[model samples]
Target: MARWRAAAFAAFLFLLLAVHCRGGKTGICYGRNADDLPSPDKVARLVQQQSIKYVRIYDTNIDVIRAFANTSVELMVGVPNADLLAFSQYQSNVDTWLKNSVLPYYPATAITHITVGAEITESPVNVSALVVPAMRNVLAALKKAGLHKKITISSTHSLGILSRSFPPSAGAFNSSYAHFLKPMLEFLVENQAPFMVDLYPYYAYQNSPSNVSLNYALFSPQSQGVIDPNTGLVYTNMFDAQVDSIFFALMALNFKTLKIMITETGWPNKGAAKETGATPDNAQTYNTNLIRHVVNDSGTPAKPGEEIDVYIFSLFNENRKPGIESERNWGLFSPDQSAIYSLDWTGRGNVDIMTGGNITGSNGTWCVASTNVSETALQNALNWACGPGDVDCSAIQPSQPCYQPDTLISHASYAFNMYYQKKGATDVACSFGGAGVRTTKDPSYDACFYLDSEKIINTNSTPPPAPSASSPSLPGLCFTLLLPVLPIVIASGFL
Candidate 1:
């Protein structure tokens, strides 16, 4: 009986751990090219308040790194493109930079990786020539400091590196960039770092809205997706197709062993007149749909079951960005620290757990209140979210207020399943929330929608009127916020 009791306890513990890690997990790239944003500490609180665990910054800013000290979040810092020229030429400078900037803020600040350069391969400048050397020097410096094994060194590349991507199987690298890429791949393989790529399907659609099907780009089920003639693989969405194109590109180079990580991917909420596809609704759909697909661990056709690690384009939109209007519109949050939209992490919505005085189902903007969260619930959530790493469970501090979400789910509408393949596990498990959205005045959304792994359960009933004038608009067809718990109103149409 005692043995049976022990086994039952072990099973219960395992179940708890599984629930913790499952669902639409997300990370943000906190690029501070703008000077008007909050301090690093304040930003850290904002990120924590959203319950985000991963952040990638443009540079190893000391204040930003230190501000995150003792927090469980994982950080990836970068070596800017302009600095690559010098970092490649001066070995001593590499060592000095590490000693001064990275080493002192090690385990304390949760610095997990260093990006040698941002989008080097796609840069028009001959700076691409310096990427290899810069990476080599940075790795050497880390090795010299005896930290090579602990911290990874990598670089982000724009999808512009691809010469052709239409039929994903026929994807190939730009021949002109081959000279620099071969050696870069070797270095990446030797160090076991990911070949990071920044993919933007929205750009493809925006550039050729007439040719691309809106449903295909937005992960809508009704669209008849494309099929690669060469590989005979059918892709239902552009995001998966983009990923497969990269996979095929790597396979062509015989670097099949290298892991692929998406360093950035997001939609723009606003854009210039020519950029008509950019809108808040479209951005919400693209990001929310992408998150559901990811947390579900839906790998590309070429690599099913592979957990694709990704970092969304940005945490906050920078007003100072110097590019087209769209350049500054990719943030999940706006400059004033308000969420650009809401995400439904928990499939069941309608509960009114609004955070920071943002009333449930209201249009008013509510920001995360603090930099740190309440230690107890968040840590419990974290322990449930991430498997036991080397994290010191007892040492965790409270995170600021996470977006308080309201759950209006009064009954089980349907058995929604979000399955993701565990990092090292062979078995696929139910992960992420995969609830479909319906916009109606209907208070009982359960009556209008049913959900599955690959399809949405359609009841086809026009939802009744919303409960109050304050109730958020009806959720969109394919997009709804899927992460931060804040109250979000929904609307339909492709941005």
Candidate 2:
């Protein structure tokens, strides 16, 4: 009896472990720029605790991989920009990179993908040219280690690759980059690897607040939205526009079969005065909304019902990150492994980092955590806001507004509706107000309604026939006078 019980216990444990490993392919960018973050092992615990099954590290950090050993988390490691030039010239360099940086952590850490270079287009060096050769060498090295099929090799890109990307359908790659891009696409298609891009709609809005709608960019519940002339497809959110822009660019390149994965996409919790859309409210709005869309396996307008995979930009903010303040502030968590923002992936609210109500300063003066609330409370909050069939926080608000809760819900709804409407469904205008309507009211309905009384009741492409004195009928007379006076009525607010 004792032996049978032990065997049964072991079998149950194996099943539980298998279920944990099958959590899907969602990954997080585990950037290490801060000095005070929890150690790699502790960080591993945090990741597992949060149910984050995959991670992408910027470099071949041995400690990180080793810590993840024997666990289910999959890792996609990077070969830094500085090392690419060397790997490009000599195949041996890539072989060594594999042996020293990769194979050592194999089987244990589950290193699934290796990025040859990071954001080569934006790199200062002639790194773009080196990417292809380095990728080829890395593949060869992987084969040498008998780990070829186990790991994927590719490079990540920024949205800057698109020379034209406004309407998305009209997207095109820069003429200057076609030489390299053409071959790169061929390689990716042959290898069965995805083309990764770091997309952020927040930057677009920041650069052009006058043209980009805050709701559209931040995934708000507002905006009349713009229609793509070529596709007659309306874009409710800027993120979808950015993604489809890449799709259009690829299609134009004659590589329509290639898969595009978003490797990084998130908003900053802090920013300079000039950076208009970087507020916590907007960040919470963008990320929370983004999470809802991602969990649903949402795709871009051009590829509806497709399961588009994306990795949120980062797990924690790094004070050490150089450049604009926003660079150091894009983390979903504070340095101490506490969530900087609350996400609805688990289907409830705790303390959302974007709101700063549940998040607090724990890692340092600048960091925050959701330590005050109990796990049950956090889970309940998530269920209330995130669970399927649950009342959408934005749609079913209190009859009387609770300033904090209402605003958070409004922002969350905007982000969720914008992303889903654009990516999941065929109706774009339905997600966004058709034109000039603006309101953040619900998940399924536009807050603002189109109210143009001057417009004809029905869409008529041709003008009506002229009425003669003898043939002046009551219906024609009334219609002619009504048409002329409609503009005045609308202007006078009497319609």
Candidate 3:
């Protein structure tokens, strides 16, 4: 009886851990300090279309806040450093600010957290000193409104807060900033909010080329890993090493179990002439691997199987920023709402890579149900592809040319490939969530002439471009977003 009880408890614990990770799932930063950007509503649409669930914005811009109303996107708003003094000095100021900035958009906005000041330790001593007081006032105001329980309160930090971080075990906070941080840490513990910190392995590698291995910083599979002498833990990627450094630093400060949130971590897509590793390919690799790491829930060596919630920095590239070229290029999307590169949030299954600089897909392509995919998923995908997706389902209908033996798998294969062909044969088009997979083998049968991948890719014989909203719309046919190919949206035509 005792053994059975322990087994049941262990199973329950595993499920609980999964739920926690889901709550702390990956999110993106929506910074709008640029001029040539899309309207907040369109941006909100783009975010949802990409299936991103959580977001962190620099401030509670009314336009952006209004945009996210009633959406599934969980938001974390900020109290900029400029407002710190006023917010800290008066509770009334905080109250008025919340009433004006937050309350009106309560349940609709889904504002889960309030980040009071970003990277305060990086600010001047006067400003840094006000962060805690400002946070306290904000907390008080939230309590008064009965929102304290629902909305968490915390601030972001730079890794510079830690003075010693080389060996994972030796990490410690900088003595100069301890006075500002100790209370902040105490408040976070008391409130049960995560300690948000900005971590950039790109800058770490860029700054110290002589010492940092480029492959390790890029999270390459072939990179020889670093083994911490004290902990004897091997760190192949710079991301894990950097995270564990803060973990140890917190442990040394006696806050052993505080949760850490990676508020900002991303690679720049472009940079100056001297920026060796700041190319599009490297950025793709870094971010793709980053997603895979987080999705797999592969925690640091010090905390294996633990959850590490992350928010990639900057949704759209900023053009007006005053910094190196790389600073302006840490965006997943361009200013035009185009994706910088394709990235899967869950990183499940294999990514479809374009070859020879052509997104027409590789030499050959076929679409079929993915291995181990559920029948229910395949049936839904089949319905979407044939019905709203507007594929030529007549080929698979009864007594038709493609229909034979009449299996769900057979009907799905025909529809999936047809839909893939219609969408210009882009790799992402073939992904019907996880139910569909692209293959090189032709699944065509006698009298059922299916188009090859190359036929769709050819400009001369390809289908006409998708019509605009004002133009005659194709019934049930899903089209890709017109710009640099982006992520898959929920309720996609392909699905």
Candidate 4:
């Protein structure tokens, strides 16, 4: 028993050191686009605890930089799209940015890469034209400062940049961006920096659920594989296919030697209605398999035996990220810094994944505030459930079926469960700032249906359209609760 314990401890240390040495492919993207997340210091500690050595932030926030300082984690800092024009035009601005942002905490921070802009092709700002110029200027500035070789410089592109990618070999850049892409490719090759791209099989499968196999998108080996006729490469998963497509695209452009780094790739563990296969089951499968696949150092078919670096889409789900619900739900850890899923990262269970709140595909479900939860926390969550969280809370109004009992607890429970059910009955969704709890016991009262997973509103039963301002009281505000009294109380939480 003593020998086993000693061996386990040594193995754990080795896993951490291995991750630190290579900046493992199992990195996390730290997105701060939310309000309720823990501070960077806490999050950085969480990253180290997970033994995650690579981190990519969407922008160069010094707080985040300082959080990872002296922690031996490799970081890829970003330059927001808004700064692209300035970064492209002025060598002085790049110098100033590097001096202020990069030099101050660099070696201690393990700042490995500086991603100038993210998904430039997908940005509506036409900043795609400024990417290479910005990169060139930044590189020049880094070179002038003697940190050029130390910090690799590049920009992240989306898979949307590919015009043709299905066959993998036929992958080519969209003709429209030839002006921007060619020069950018040249810069990456000359500087020996890797080409970074955000790839999402979730988006691919979600967009074409009918034709694409859900199992294949989730990286399940049981999937009916697709064969690329040109290379005779049989792909059991969409991740390898998407990656090989870029390899083919780069080779077609004669930039065969450049490294490929996946800047962001993840399955959203939850998403809004109409998004098929976005669940904890699928997410855990994709991410777990991705980590194993990367750790095996088995490169994609096109780039055989080569290791590629990848950063997972996010560390925490950002509540304020705009777009579909999936945009806000691609987190590995809950906002409270709890693991939402488990992984045998070291093959020894050295990392204890949090399993307390992983409620999925259960026999039943109920969302209720814990007995001792704070009224203030419950009220804020109630506000979120109704307003931006988009719980259909109309039935909880004074005159409605669910409003028989006027107590805040009763009304909040109804709103919370509705939001919870709509969010795939996941315990994380029911987390109303830790005030909420998931229960198997039904809390349904008279004329009120406290839904469980079994009682899910049929997929065909669409939620009622949100009340419009022109006809109703307000545009974005929720019309649930005792309309007058509830909205006033909820507004104070925001204040």
Candidate 5:
């Protein structure tokens, strides 16, 4: 009996580790170019309310940095193009910036990446030569502060760096950028940083509607797949094709090991009349599918199963942005902190954002761990529920209200219910790898209350629209909660 139990536990642990190892995180870009944007504190609250774990801002605004202090959200701060020259000129300049901007609020704010510049290659003025030197200076400053390992240093680029993107396998960078591109690629490889690129399928379709179909660009189910002639790889969506093109471009330059991160990508909700593809429906479809694609760990055709982190562009629309109407309309929310359309940051449900409404009317349903399932399965589900599933498991900790029961079942139930409720209280969210079940009965014991669907309402200034059943359901990503007493429970034969 002991040997069998040990084997079962080992298998369960393996499964839990597999779930934990899988990557791909979805984040949002918080742009504040407009005058009507919310205060930094309010914006931080809005981000937290939405359960957005990762955020990328254009600069190291002290107010924005301080706003996220003590929050779980990880920030990727930037150094503007204008500052690149000054930073590159002297290491002291970079150190001073880091001292004032970063050191004051670092671990408290969870700042992860320090992007040196944004799309430097596409800048109107040729400041391209200073990028690598600035990056080196930034790295030196980080090393001086012993933060080189903690905070990654890199730069963002536009897809314009690629001269040939068709056939994906034949993709290569423009030779004109070799002076900087070669050194930049080498620096990225040495430092183990990702090659950040801003990929917009909306622009691809807009520039050539005759060639790029709207369905293909939107990642629609009805779109016919485009086959790469050189490698016989089929690209069902333009996002993957564009990503694979970058991969191939890197491979052509012999820098295949470096990972890629999507620094910016989104469709506009509104645009000028000539921009036929820009509409609420199209934007909703594109972003919704893109989120699903990234969080699902669905890598491009070139690198199957490789996890890629992606950040959607512009959290709020900037009225001051100078360009066509579409250039100013990539925000997921309006200036008043209302969701333009609802998005499940967890990436599980397939509810429509365009004709939005409340997620589900059922407020009484609760998800709990099944009594019939093996304890090992319940433990696995519990770990997943707390980790990637993003369930707030603090209540179940010691001295907390829910800590009395102290059984695996109690903790797992609390986590499962939170996960279920967050995922719109859907039957699918309650699966928990078949270790969970939905029940109308209240699972709350004393002060240990399980979250219901009604409690999962949007916290925006304006209530979000009800979810429409237009999109297809995605497979649930199980989250893991780190229970400190799991070993004790097992040793005590609680199973």
Candidate 6:
């Protein structure tokens, strides 16, 4: 009996951990090419409040690195292009730099990746030759510090490196970069570091609107997907097509197993008249859908269910960046730290207008099952909500206060609202693949009260309401007792 209890307890713990597992993670880039941006400390706080887990910065400025210390946020620091030649010339240069900038606040700040340079291919100066040497020196320094395995070393590249990207299977790199890329690809494969590239579907669409549709670029549900004739695979979004193109490019070079990471990708919120696709709505739509696609493990047609880590191009709009109007407006937030528009980092597809750095919504909004959808769809959504969605459905079980209604809609409403509130009451949380709907009216009954965003602001503090007096409350007690056996039941398909 003792051994059985211990095994059951272990399974229960494993189940709890698995509930929160995600296929991919979304991170944001923190660029400070502006004079009016907030201090790093404030920026860190804002990032934490928004539940962001990873941040990439251009350089390892001490103040900025120190600001993220003792925080959950992970840092991906970089070596600027200007300093690449110096670092590449000598390992001692990288050693000294790491000793001062990294060794002090490494584990505390959670510094993960050290990107050597940004877009060396696009750099005005011909510093492409220095990239591999700089990377080697950085790797040697990390090995000396016993951090070679802990921290990854790579450089960011622009799409310009690829000579061909259309019909993804035919993707190939430019012949001119062969010498630089071969050695770099070898280093990446040996070190097991991902090939980091900065992809911008926004640019692809902007430069050639007739070739790339706005819906295809935005990951819109209504997109009439483009078909790659060579591979016979239909691509629903430009992002996936771009990713698969890079994958094929790596395969072309015999680096088939190399992982790809999106070091930067985002849409601009504003642009000149000619830049018609650059608007706030388009930006929000592209980012929101991108987050959903990534977090949900919707990989490209070429590589189904491949996990990719993507960092949104920018954190704030840099007033200092020189280019077209769209170049200066790629930030998710303004310089003042207010969100340009809300984003649901959880990938629940909820987006709303944010004001004064707080997510605002109707006070009484609640998610319930839609009457218009078919009952079968509702059931499927309900099953999803209770299963993978991680919603608690104990309140709707027999003998509970909410069990009196005993209807599919009532039970689903409880599960949907529970999920909606748990996901910060975002509109997309109520979507449930179009089987759920949001309403401003209260759906509470005699003792079965429904939760809204306002009521469950702090989910931890507010527990579910107790059962009514007439019921013995045996269901709740039984659930608590059976919690340890849940994993066993689920694994056996007996739940």
Best by lDDT: 6
Cα RMSDs of all predictions? 16.3, 20.1, 14.5, 22.7, 13.9, 8.5
Flag the better candidate by lDDT, 5 or 6.
6
**Would you list the C-alpha lDDT of every candidate in the order shown?**
0.65, 0.65, 0.77, 0.75, 0.81, 0.82
Task: Highest TM-score: give the candidate number.
Answer: 6
- Which model is ahead, 3 or 5, in terms of TM-score? 5
Best-to-worst TM-score order? 6, 5, 3, 1, 2, 4
Off by over 4 Å in 2: 1-25, 346-495
Candidate 5 scores a C-alpha RMSD against the true structure in Å of 13.9
Clashing residue pairs in all predictions, respectively, total 33, 17, 3, 0, 15, 0
> What is the lDDT for 289 in model 1?
62
Candidate 3: 10-residue stretch with minimal lDDT: 481-490
The residue pairs that clash in candidate 6, if any, are: none
Evaluated against the true structure, the overall lDDT of model 3 is 0.77
Worst 10-residue lDDT window, candidate 4: 347-356
Which structure is stronger by TM-score: 4 or 6?
6
Clashing pairs in 3: 388-476, 389-476, 390-476
Q: How far is candidate 4 from the true structure (C-alpha RMSD, Å)?
A: 22.7
Write the residue-wise lDDT of candidate 5 on 1-495 in tens digits: 755666565555556557655569899999998999999999999999999999999999999999999989999999999998999899889999999999999899999998988998889889989999999999999999999999999999999999988878888999999999999999999999999999999999999999999978987644555867676665768988999999999988889999999999999989999998888777777877787666656566567546899999879999999999998998989999998877777766553333434345335878888786667667877887787566788999999999879999999999989877765565435655456677889888788777676655543237435534432122223323324435764886734
Q: Residue by residue across 1-495, what tens digits does model 1's lDDT show?
A: 655544554454345445434543467889887767888898899888877788999898899999999888999999999899899999999999999999998889888888988887656677988989999999999999898998999888888899998889888999998888999999999999999899888888988888897767776543455757775555667888888888899999999989888989988888999888788777776766676567656566566445677788878777888889999888887777888886543222222221212112212211111112223322332333333221122212233121112211211111111111112110112111111122222222322221321121233355657645333333343122222212221121111
Misplaced by over 4 Å in model 6 are 1-20, 350-495
